[model samples]
Target chain A: MLMEKSAVENGFIIDLSSIKNTSQLVFELSSIMEHPDVKGKNICLKLGSLDLKQSQLLSIKALIESMNAKIAFIDTKSEQTEASAVSLGIMIKEISSDLTADIAPSEEDFKDSEYKEEAVEERTENPVQDTNSQEIVEVHTEVHNNPIETTEGIEDIYDEVSAQELSEVIPSENYQPDGFGILAASEGLLPEETSKYILLDTGNVLPEGVEENSVNTESMQTLYINQTLRSGQTISYDGNVFIIGDAHPGSEIIAGGDITVWGILGGIAHAGCNGNITSKVRALKLNAIQLRIAGLYARRNDTLNVPYVQKTNEFTPEEALIEDGKIVIYKKLRRD
Target chain B: MTGRVIVITSGKGGVGKTTTSANIGTALAKSGYKVVLIDTDLGLRNLDLLLGLENRIVYTIVDVIEERCKLRQALVKDKKNPNLQLLAAAQTRDKTAVNAEQLKEICDTLKEENDFVLVDCPAGIEQGFQNAVAGASEAIVVTTPEMSAIRDADRIIGLLATKEEITSVKLLLNRVRPNLIKSNEMMSVDDVVGILEIPLVGIIPEDAGIITSTNKGEPIVNDENALAGKAYRNVAERILGEEVPFLDLDEPKGFMAKIKNAIAKLKVKV
Candidate 1:
């Protein structure tokens, strides 16, 4: 994922423009920092529109510093990262066009077309740069939209990266009011926490004597709970279970039918534990550590580092169900 | 040599038990000792990820207990240090898969060849914790500067008292923000030690470097200039029966300190 390694006057340029998520960026950046050539050298980071929290940016800065190297400056299109860099006293200087022109990474290296198109537009504004990048610059501007939607391919990306990064980006791009895609797969790729739930290799994690069956859950009695489920607390029902408050991590909810949580579900939710394949788990914020449906069990991805503290209060509701023997999550866009 | 098996445990979760285990284990190994770190947080393992040895794990403690793989094969060597090895916990199996007797047997075998066997116990005093403490004679109860963590650590110390095999149980206060303590916003190390009523082993400052080191899959103890790393190294020396003083956690704000830090970095580079 690290391309365009160039040595500057007294430093090295580790262009992390290709990688999208923070974890992958750090994962790759730390690996690059381990190389003897990059050690103790002033490092210039070209971060293309990756929104990072001040704490996250500070950790990146510390990671660079711990390697006995210093970050001379960073080039980013993200205001959050810029604010973070300013607060941390790290310099925010855009790599000069002349410096980048000599070792510019190809346009295809970018994962987000929205940001890549802007970078291309910058080259288009400057016609005097070089004849080499003019052709590639013209090609990027033509196809402005890149994959308007990420459909039936989340489980695909999970097949490529290692288990530590084994995750599918949440289908957030599909929440575009079912219209012209406002953003390509860019916004959904932030934070490197795409896969909210990863399938556990444990075969048939259901309790003993429970068999897989897709019964009509609507006919079953529903257990309603109003209090928040804390750690180690458990709620088990032979039918459906609906919770009005949040289910914190370490709590367990097992239902024979469907499980609906009005608040954030951050615990383990097992729907149709008695074996109803049609049973689904829905929550205002489906951040369950383990999502279980029928006999299939999927734990939260190891790298799903959701910032516990954020300014925005927006939470897109989500639903998880069994589709073709795989637990596929669908974005539940509110009609209101 | 019969290596001392020390279980790093905290009754409460998110109190940095695994982080302490990884760091102390790494620090001990760096001091020219044969160290074997065992992660017993089955189905929720993280020790491998912190050490950046996740990809190298071919088998786990479950595989060793079940005889699916020999104990020697389950030991994944660290990337930078051959003296540091890890026996990862199985991510697919729950805590019930292994019992206390089985864990003790594994620890006994591991202690014969290694100088230190650090068991990273999972949260809660359930079967997982029992299995972790089964084979250990020494314990380090890790806690943060919070009432909840201290309360849990107290309970853990009480539980460790009932074990005939456990000879020592020391408290290692983690995430001690000295500035916050100075302003009376957070608990001080003395207060924590008073409540827990255990011998002090180490006091780790809340450093942002830990977060980066965790994500990088390298322990902070590897970074010689990191204060947290230096504190962990001191903890290892204490484990080896050295009389080391605790670090002064006052936030360094002097210009002279800056020059000293810069000079230290320059020395490390050279």
Candidate 2:
């Protein structure tokens, strides 16, 4: 006889192969039931190998029940063994060659059992299955290999259905409204009262006739360089760039997003290289010979025409951004 | 005693690495310690000239490394201090003539006899720098207040930090203009030390005496009256595990000297 054991959540498996006699089967079953690991867990018996008489099947079921534990079995190909298992009140779990079958029990099998009557009632109460099942399928595929995830999906569906049925089963006349009026009053002030005033204050809310643009915006990643970018060094990134040290004259940095330098920046910096016109560059000391953002370029000789409050001859911290299709430099306001 | 081999390196040229090496070697020798100065600039040797021993060179470092002459025979004795010596680099040979392993071997043999071995490294972070720092246990990075020199000095400090043999690295801010620093135009010694994040070994002010001493084929440390001379002497003492306070660069001279000069002027007027 061939025997194999596998452990499942709150359950254990016993696969029997080519048992010769009733005595051998009894000894194996008793030894497994007495196992420390299998003592409290439900038993799943694979009966594909053992073709036994009706009396022998009843005896095994009775022996399992005597241990105060529930037992389920994968039905054998033989009609005699399958009928014997169903007649004896033993669960004949749907058999599949795939191991995932043990985790994902078929819905039909779940509805057939008298033990799952509550689950069937719950499913009948809830009509919104499309959205719920779609989410379940997503979660199931993400963790396809985890047996716990499969079991959790089944339990979630059952819980949702059961909860709906429980609400329906209660009489509506007996139900009392307890503080629900206050909760509804509080929720009513949420969207209409607060958001309406916020939109009014901004004065730039989109008109009702205008549909909001659904632009796909990717999250921008930032690359940080902790050391100075010396001459002959170049750093290129697909996202925002931040340099903690100086970018010397001969060095260059090209980024698809905005760039910020904590120290002196006297090099060539090209931001919004992927054609993002709104991208800007900021540095503690802006002495760059050339600055490029999107299609626009700004040279050091380009005088900043803005009305200045305090202008210094030395290279002070400033910000460069695209304005009217041209790059403009503005002195950074001290936050302190 | 097994002496320390300190490498003097500045990633940028004209930062006074040769001058600092020569002065520190002289100051250490003046303190009665036998010191050997090595000019590892290879093709651009200047340490011998700074030590005023260029004409007395019979063999160079390349000859010793190539096994053409004994290491002892290649050592040129200093005229000012008998305890100080110089191993000049070959003016014709490039840096490739001497490898890191050979330099380390030479430094190891020299350490057994000398109290200190100072190697004057060449500019740039190339083969020359690597060969100079190969056997050094300590490093002194000379940097001026200028952004370019300080940037290169920071890079050299980064490279030296990666070497396993370099146990310590210090900064020597050279050519600092006191008036510019007071006016907040030039970087102060504290600013240079803060950017470099290394211990300040010494700070040599922008002294014209340094140039005059080099012209006279003498290290400024030999001139007791020069501020730069006292700075070099203090650096040499600091290297020997002595704790000396940094000099005040704001004043033209020491407080006592300024008072004495003022009193002397008053006496002359009377």
Candidate 3:
């Protein structure tokens, strides 16, 4: 019975101490801590010689501050909490022995035991309540406390697998092989959490002011791709493309307006792509290929000598744009 | 249970899609899930032939969609498993013979009674593949380790991603040869996963039993002792959301295969 009392008291203490690294751990602790009977008893914290890092120490400090509890950190070499607690009881007796010896029969020795017993009685009398809701609130509170820390926590609230995190660990979940992470509870911090996906981080991956194009905007006239775009490559523009990218022989591209490929712009290319194209197609490297510009159609011209841009030792970003209703091509100036 | 409709598709042909669908359906049926395998191959109706149920199909899916017969009348029971059924396609029909809306409607009706509806998508990213995948809440893209197959799977995955309707699609690698994998002669599962970059549903070993089963109109997954059979069952379990660990494709050969291969190597050395 005395041991049961201590178990209840210790469980509550663990719940109140908010120094856990994982949400699962916090949940398990909260259930025990929120027990009314356990809360009523005096809880003891045996701070052994644990090498806790700053974050853990801070979290513990936060929990102690929240609960308004008295805690003393000791650097004892002992690993056993129960034995240390007993030793602590003895040490308290020795320190106060001279003063308390003349008073009521040793309240210090009985105090810890009485607190433990009361905690146990309270546990036995109370019914089990779901502490999951309390755990979630604690999780939010913890995240709110340290807005910068990203480590072991409720990795996901739903069965511990955030859909976004699930997407990352199992790359198959999100189907993005070129390095992508999932955004579980899409609080939109997902874009911020995964560094690799931050494609345009201010000082990182993407350089500053590299604004991504608005593909769906009405002003986005057309994309004129003139070079072979390889697999895993993406190019979006506000104007028409002249040609390129493996737009492999059978592939096609969609443009908001007229598209003209100077290379073997094969595959599917749409000018006035998405029906916005005052779209037309003119290809120098045109192999007789499928073409679509707005509602217009141009069959593959087998005789068309679409200029095949042969590989050279130079870095040439050949691109095309429309000026005054005609397709023009040139190499882009080096931004660097 | 309100059955889940799953479509098995590969954008390119010769990717073992039909074979994978057949095996997975058989495995799920064996697991006691009321399964209905729909052959969406249209004119190239081979799933029935793969299962050796070609002769049993009296009313093809074409007949039901065309209103020649009722959906119930068109379903052919798998002689092997009472819980498994087949909705065969028309031999004379093309992909346009059935529309995506029609297939979705058919799947909705089947989902009410069955625990799982497995659609065998025809090869090519044309209308047939679209029709088959239309109703499927989940999709499995079967591919070999070759770059060509991986490329096609990637395209299909991209399409699925852009599609607002279809929610989930997974990858299943078939015909993996462990011997070639160990010798760096073949693409490892990791290589394929890295390239296509989708959650892996299963990695089926290159088992001769698969060919033999195909020749005999038997599903490789029906052989209780076969490795590919176990692999398909693992895929089925994963579809049910069980965390089944993938088979270690790179593990050293078993004693039996090692001894046999050693003798073969000796012969080559001589």
Report clash pairs, candidate 2. A122-A161
Compute fnat per model.
Answer: 0.00, 0.00, 0.00
The per-prediction tally of clashing pairs is: 1, 1, 50
The sequence of per-residue lDDT tens digits that candidate 1 reaches over residues A81-178 is: 99766544455667765665554444333334553564456457655534422332232222212222333334333323221111112223333334
- TM-scores of all models? 0.51, 0.43, 0.42
Candidate 1 residues lying further than 4 Å off, grouped into runs, are A1-24, A27-45, A48-193, A307-313, A334-336, B1-3, B8-19, B25-134, B140-225, B233-270
**Residue range A1-336, candidate 2, lDDT tens digits:** 001132122344565444556667764565345333343345667666466654466546545544544453444655777765543334455434454334333333323254246434545754653443333223323332232321333333223222212111111122223311110011123222111011111122222443322221136888999999875477899888999988875467888788898887766687777777777788887656456676554444211111111223444466776555445554432232
Global lDDT of each model? 0.73, 0.65, 0.54
True-vs-predicted CA distance for residue B161, candidate 1, Å: 9.5
Name the candidate that leads on DockQ: 1
Residue range with the least summed lDDT across 10 consecutive positions in model 2 chain A: A179-188
The alpha-carbon lDDT assigned to residue A100 of candidate 1 equals 59
Model 1 earns a TM-score of 0.51
- Most accurate candidate by lDDT: 1
Q: Which tens-of-lDDT digit does each residue in A164-192 have in candidate 3?
A: 22322222222222222232111132222
Error (Å) of candidate 3 at residue B263 is: 18
Interface RMSD of each: 14.1, 43.0, 32.7
Q: For this target, which candidate reaches the highest TM-score against the unseen true structure?
A: 1
For candidate 1, give the lDDT. Answer: 0.73
